[model samples]
Target: MEENTFKKGLIDGLPIGIGYFSVAFAFGIFALRCGLKGWQAVAISATNLTSAGQIAAVPIIAVQGSLVELASTQLVINMRYFLMSVVLSQKLKPETTVLDKLIIAWCNTDEIFAVCTGKDYRLDKRYCFGILIPPYLGWTLGTLAGVLAGDVLPAIITDSLSIAIYGMLIAVFVPAGENDRNMLMCIAISVALSLCFFYLPYLRELPGGFTIIICAVAASVFMAVKAPVGGDG
Candidate 1:
């Protein structure tokens, strides 16, 4: 029996959804640390699924950072989404319309992109929409859980939860680096530059948001020019 494509999307998204819960749970705790109330933390997760952007934004908000800092930081961090959306557009069925594309763009995430692109055939709007449901629910619920837990858990326990987000970041880094030597160099350069921002005099004084923007752009551009993935393929 042929399974429905929508059903296939939901099933495929399940693992990604589960993984997101664990990561989002940690993010919930981190949001609390940044002085966001429980509802605000949950709202952020519900509305925006980009964990890195959330992490970057929450701290800035906590410190009452400038609007320029918030806007520039989020733009730099999330600029990749435009690229990702463009790439995913290529995978849609020929009959897909502008409104359908707009909906897909709203729901797209890194995990969803990986799932949709891993297959060979063109995807319809049904499958694309179906796949996003589980992840969206999991992320929102996880944040809610984290917020509730943060309110009650001892500081010692909540502090221990800090490691989970770092783990999530490493999980993102390792796979790309392992597959491509060039990408590994990019990751290494980004890490080294970030450490300098953390420790070096004068450089350490730069605003956190700009420091991230500079390091990320510098490493990505240096590597892309040096290696030029698939040589313009």
Candidate 2:
């Protein structure tokens, strides 16, 4: 049974593994262009897997942002993961161990979490780690390859492939988003708030990364406040 489950995870994970390769390749190219070493780029993606956070940090690093600002920025941007971790913990069985949780947590990107939470996934440690290794390696290798290749590709091709990460984000959100009204509302509110942040003078001038945090938090709080009580339809 466990063997079959692991096989299922691998099969389900294959497409995402390919996409991660391409997207992480873009990150690698940009990182290298910004004067980071290939290994440094690979290490950053492997540990963080937070593309927005990484890209934000790069410019801030270039400008030598203060340590306090960097830490605060990362925390604010990554706060959503705290909510995700809480939801994921609920899906885990009672007997799930500390070691198992630690291993699984390492692969808790948006894509991986979608697979784990859909229906009765019963995601054990072996299945979690199995799904993790291939995609993780693909990301690392793509970064390395991109750095080594170094500017051979034209600008248009790079720009097109840069959308791959956005594609991954849409995939992660759309499925469960259909069934959950709260999630749908949160997404809609976030999008509306994000647009406002982009176009409204003072808000528009706010940094891109900080805008994401503001929209997310505002949308979440709005939903919590507005959710109907006892399915009072």
Candidate 3:
């Protein structure tokens, strides 16, 4: 039974692994362009498992932002993971130990969270590890390739590949936005707020990380007030 669960996790994670490779490839190229070493790029992917946050950090790092700036940026950009982790904890099997949960939490990316939570039963450590391994490898390998080839790759190709991450984000959100009104509304709100922040002179000065945090919080609050779930008042 454990073997079956592990195999099932690997099977379900295959698509996520493919997606990670494509997205992380772009990230690797971007990181190299931002002056990170090949090994550093690979380390980032291996340790962080986040595209948007890492990409955001590159420019900040290039600018030699202070530790506080880096910490705040990461906090705002990756705050969703904290919420996801809390939700995921509920989906873990009762027998899953604290250490297992800690390790699983460290490995939890958005895709991994989705797969683990989508399961009909609570997830075990083995199944969670099985699901995490392929994508982790794919992301790390892709980053390594990008870093190594960054100088060798044509400018046009690298530029084009950089757009892949945005495409992936759209792919993740669009389907749910199509099926759910609240999701669509929340997306619209976030986009509108982001644009406002971008164009408005005063708000435009805000850092990208803070902009994302404000937009996310405002949109979520609006959505909750306007369309509370579970028929709650």
* Worst ten in a row by lDDT for model 1: 160-169
lDDT tens digits, residue span 154-225, model 1: 767655655664564466668878978988999899989999999999999876656776787799899879
C-alpha lDDT score of every prediction, in listed order: 0.80, 0.77, 0.80
RMSD of each: 4.3, 3.3, 3.5
For residues 165-200, write the lDDT of model 2, one tens digit per residue. Answer: 778778778875697888898899999999999999
Count residue pairs with overlapping backbones in model 1: 0
Q: Which candidate, 1 or 2, would have the higher lDDT against the true structure? A: 1
TM-score of each: 0.70, 0.84, 0.80
Cα displacement (Å) at residue 182, model 2: 5.4
Cα lDDT over the full model 2: 0.77
Model 2 clash pairs are none
